[model samples]
Target: MKYIFATFLLLNTFHLFGQESAPINHELSFQFDNDLLFFDAGDRYYTNGLFFTYRQKIKEDRSWSNLFGFQSLHKSIFHVAFVSKIFNPYNLKGEKAEEIDRPYAGELYVDGLYTSYWGQNRLAVGVDLGWLGTKTRSDDIQTNLHTTFGWVRPRGWRDYQIHDTPIAHLYTGLSREIVSIGPLSLISDVDVRVGTINTNAAAAITMRLGRSQPLDASVLTHARTGERIANDRKCKELFFVTKTQLMHVFYDATIEGNIIGEPSPFVKSAEPWVWMQSVGVMLSMKTFDLQALWSFLGREVVGGRPHKYGTLVIAKRF
Candidate 1:
């Protein structure tokens, strides 16, 4: 319901920035991303996604985080993360001068945080050992983006989830500390994917709207059922986004959906529902976040076919 007034004012505004009265401090940072105008639904692509995050708090509860990621396409990273799914089961073919190593999708996490005696908000429990090369990687950005629905990919990059079976996974997450206005801060998180889709679910709502207020908004939603595409089981998505950080630097727009039954080839059982839209902009730099997007699909309720487009993403996160 419109995120219930920004998730109840971001849970009482995280009790005022999850305060600790200022004292325990330690910092580390690293981020790099470059999609350079990429699109998956229509399959017009370009990707260079590299994410590395490491954080250690060791005292205020406990924390350990490590995530090293890589993806490459006309700019290869094993043909953009190598895929087939469930994890992987040998499916790598090469071309364009060879060196196609088959599998690797990094992920490692250890966590424990409960800082709310008035620290504001904190409650976490984690564990996720990973590998699932791309083919949508089940569509990331935290898997739940609502505008209509989710899951879209036409060819190479939609590889059954890294090639169908390579397991060693575990996940659990719950984070809440919603509400911070005036530089804008609102966060909500939920994750439970455990041992690979028994009842997968993910949710996130974040609004940090302020770098001098150009405008920022985020919404992600996800649900699961086997991973679809053969009888088209079940999948859900909604990613309504709004970004404009101080006159450009990065601008965005999104609305996507896909639901099916009568053997969806892109939904046309008389059309269950398929919608897409993307806008663009990126030119300054808070940390260089570029942008570009144009996508297609509509068949009743909004109509369709305008060029069947694609292109969006140009990243740099320092």
Candidate 2:
């Protein structure tokens, strides 16, 4: 952990010193998921997890743009970030947990993206590198600790040799404003991801209704890579936003294990389709932003049950 933090600090320092004159924005946010919202007694697939993300953006029009030749490439902005998350599966909880064989896991991801805008439309392309699964003995220890603290009875020890894998993927997404009527505007977004390990595609349409003058188009889209800091000085706004998204996955290595190998105990026959419907309200001011969303998720496998989760995001901009 120390090494990871040091590396992050080093990269941040480099970017800060190298782009001293560029307008930079930094945002940090957390996401928590639990099955209690769905009135379930025990945690199962997609159980409790906490995700943390740090995002930093550098404006392309600044002096650092010359160093990166971004203008020459027609890119409007550069973004780099890191994400870390710890998630536990069904086996980590309860006395009857042995029925489910999934193991607790940790995920570390690093991504960089370039974005460009044309009128009300925006495009982003990025590459993500992820390390999924337990990295060391300490990871398992921490998982046990977290489970214990959460009031789950800890299973003494178990085999986790089948875990640990690396993932590399490339993704591109587009966001566009479709129409506007009075203070309501409709925005559409599409994201596609393909990699050696997993492949998925998703699309969403959102409706934003509020004071038109303070609503920033960027806030209506769900793609975090495409999000941008509003440049206008008057940033106070409140918007009621609702979005529905559908996603289909050709493959998910995480659930099914590696694509090339024999299946693990946790592997189930892959289910390629899923859907999510979300409704959220966002409040943005000059210095901070807050959004609360409730989402309903469809079954990921043939016999699986649908679930619901809530997400709250709070971000401070500097």
lDDT of each: 0.27, 0.58
Could you give me the TM-score of model 2 versus the true structure?
A: 0.72
Residues 12-52 of candidate 1: C-alpha lDDT, one tens digit per residue: 23221223233212211222222223333322111223322
Task: Quote the RMSD, in angstroms, for model 2.
Answer: 6.6
How many Å off is the CA of 59 in candidate 1?
36
Number of colliding residue pairs in each model: 30, 0
The residue-by-residue lDDT of candidate 2 on 116-143, one tens digit each, is 5555666778898877665634356555
Candidate number of the best lDDT: 2
Stretches of candidate 2 exceeding 4 Å from the true structure: 1-26, 30-42, 48-57, 61-75, 86-98, 101-105, 136-142, 145-150, 154-162, 212-217, 221-235, 260-265
